[model samples]
Target: MRYVIAVAETGGFTRAAERCHVVQSALSHQIARLEKDLGTRLFDRTSRSVRLTAAGEAFVPVARQAVEAADRARAEVEAATGVVRGRLAVGAISTVAAVDLADVLGRFRAGYPEVRISLRMGMSEELIEGVRQGALDVAFIGLVPGTRPKGVRVRKMAHGELVAVVAPEHPLAGTEQTDLRRLAEESFVDFPTGSAARRQRDAAFEAAGLTAEAPFEITSVESLAKLVRANLGIGMVPEAVAGELRGLHVLRVRNAPTREELLVWNSLGPSPAAAAFLSGLGIDPSERSQRSGRSERSERSA
Candidate 1:
């Protein structure tokens, strides 16, 4: 199963062998034997490329789950003997600032050297989905105010308001403060049109009965700052995020949109490695309930 998983993920027998620390012929022989036992071809081999057959595509996920379950059982047995060892898959957004991930991860590694860590960076929606699917053990996601992701145990990490940012030479640079309505008059550089970040900014303008245009769309805060610095368009970002960016004039906004940074894990529970990491964050995973609405609100506040 491990060899098949490596082959399916790496997409070639040669690379898969290298990853599994075996010779190509040995890996190939194992896969061939497995396919014969299963009565189906798992892979289609060509000179230039290797691809999963329909059976292989269907088999890979189940194979991964089986492998993970076995590993988890082993880790649990080891934990019973006073050693915690397993894989920790963590996901987060690029603009995360509620906690210093580097510092936290460094500490986690120091304390749990037996655990292997993998990090993935993506948008909030994507990261949330990862947590739901069990592909990610834990995630840090940023959402618009009042936004709640389902099927996960959540803990609110931090909350902040968004502010308008403009180029130093732009007209709003001289202003100390502005409202969303005033900022709506300018072209904006923002996250994708329907993204949570963009929607948060949009909600602020909408509440004030205004409309804003985003002619420049960017994925990262640094890129948005670059566009603002070039005078291409103004932007809205969390106050904490804005402070980390240089060369932009930050203007306080009246009735600014708010964002919530949250820590989310599988609703069923966390893996042992995930539980250990959560403890480092001063969070008690056992206290988190499967229901993550009002109960979550109360827990986070406490």
Candidate 2:
């Protein structure tokens, strides 16, 4: 029943397998066996599409109620017994999580001591996908600003700007502010393509109508700063990181485009432990009003 629900919720077998943490063949076999026992087909599959058959449409609601009722019963029993024990999967970008995660985790541990917290770190795009597929209970990510996945919910945490970092002896290091386009031809150390950090860098350059010559691509903000300090190339990094990396000069750029940090989750059917974890963050999972700010530009993925 849970596997069927996952398949229905995610819209495809492959995604359902990922969410359930099972091999596709195993999930298919189990679901097929389930259908055989029920003596009716549950899904109609084709090369490009999958949907419920007429009998499936009639059966799914009952199956969903059974799954949801069992979950609620388990949550209620845990609450009544004062034993909060379930796994909570959380994902985040390394840099963003550094802001207040230690503190959040500390408080969360105190509140739900029996809850097993699993922390996974990755790029924002992948993190968002994790939330969409129900692999992660919640995530902290950087986004440009726009529509999110159908069932996932989003709340803005911060809307902010990043500054340029250069070697201490570099010309722009001593300057209070620099024109963004002036360094178009300079060697640059930047985030690799398809990463949220890279997207921000690319968007800023495109907004200014200047081509970036970032031949040195990287993923870690720390690594990017190290390269800048070595005088290999200048890089753009968050203000928090700019303040910390040794021998690096931080320069404010004129009208630098901003990025947003967001908390993404699916509140409707989150794991019991995950829901408790959200409460510890001062987030009422069901409250959309928890979202704070909006970027002026179009929205991107979490």
Candidate 3:
């Protein structure tokens, strides 16, 4: 199954064999034997290309799950004997503030040299879904206040509010304070509409019965800051994130939206590597929240 999955992901047999650390001929022989046993061709090969047959498309996902389950089972047994070994898949939003991700990952690698670590940067909603679907073992996400992600175990790490950020020469620069209504009058540059990042501020404007226009849609926090620094339009970002961005004037907004930083993992249970990561962060992986849908707060030190 691992070989098949490697082949599907790599898109060819030669590369898949190299990745599997086996000769191409042996890998091909094994695949052919498996296909013959199953009475179906998993891939179609030509002189120029190799692609999965319809049957192969249907088989790869299950194959991946089986392979992962086998690996996890072995890792769990090893962990029971006081050793950790397995893959750790982590996801997070680009603008994480409560915990320093790179530093955390660096420390984790130092402590668990045998564990393979992978990190993915995405929007909050997508990261939540990744944890729920088992594609990611753990995730760090930010959500609007009073909101909670469904179907995953969560722990609140910290809470923060949004602030207005403008270029140094903008009219709002050097201003200590502003409100949502006042900021609504200015053009804005923000995340794409309908995204959770965009919705954080959008909900505030909506509650005030106002509509703010963000003509430039940006998908990344860094890009949005760059656009704002160029005086294209003003922007709203988490207060903690604003402090880290150089060359921007950060202002406190009276009615700014607030968000909560959270750590999420599979509700069923965390993988061994994930459990180790949680423990390293001083979080108890076995602890469950008593607040029903909402997770309890467990802040980490910087």
lDDT (Cα, 0-100) at 293 in candidate 3: 49
Residues 24-133 of candidate 1: C-alpha lDDT, one tens digit per residue: 99999999999999999999999999999999999988898788878878987888898889999999887788999989999999999999999998778788878887
Displacement of residue 4 (Cα, Å) in model 2 is: 18
What's each prediction's TM-score? 0.90, 0.69, 0.88
Model 3, 141-191: lDDT tens digits are 877765667778888888889999999999989688999988999999988
1 or 3: which has the higher TM-score? 1
Ranking by lDDT: 3, 1, 2
Candidate 2 — what's its lDDT? 0.76
Return the TM-score for candidate 2, rounded to 2 decimals: 0.69
CA lDDT of 183 in candidate 2? Answer: 72
Off by over 4 Å in 1: 289-302
Poorest stretch of ten by lDDT in candidate 3: 293-302
Q: Tell me how far candidate 2 lies from the true structure as C-alpha RMSD in angstroms.
A: 7.0
Name the best candidate (by lDDT): 3
* Model 3 residue pairs with clashes: none
lDDT of 1: 0.86
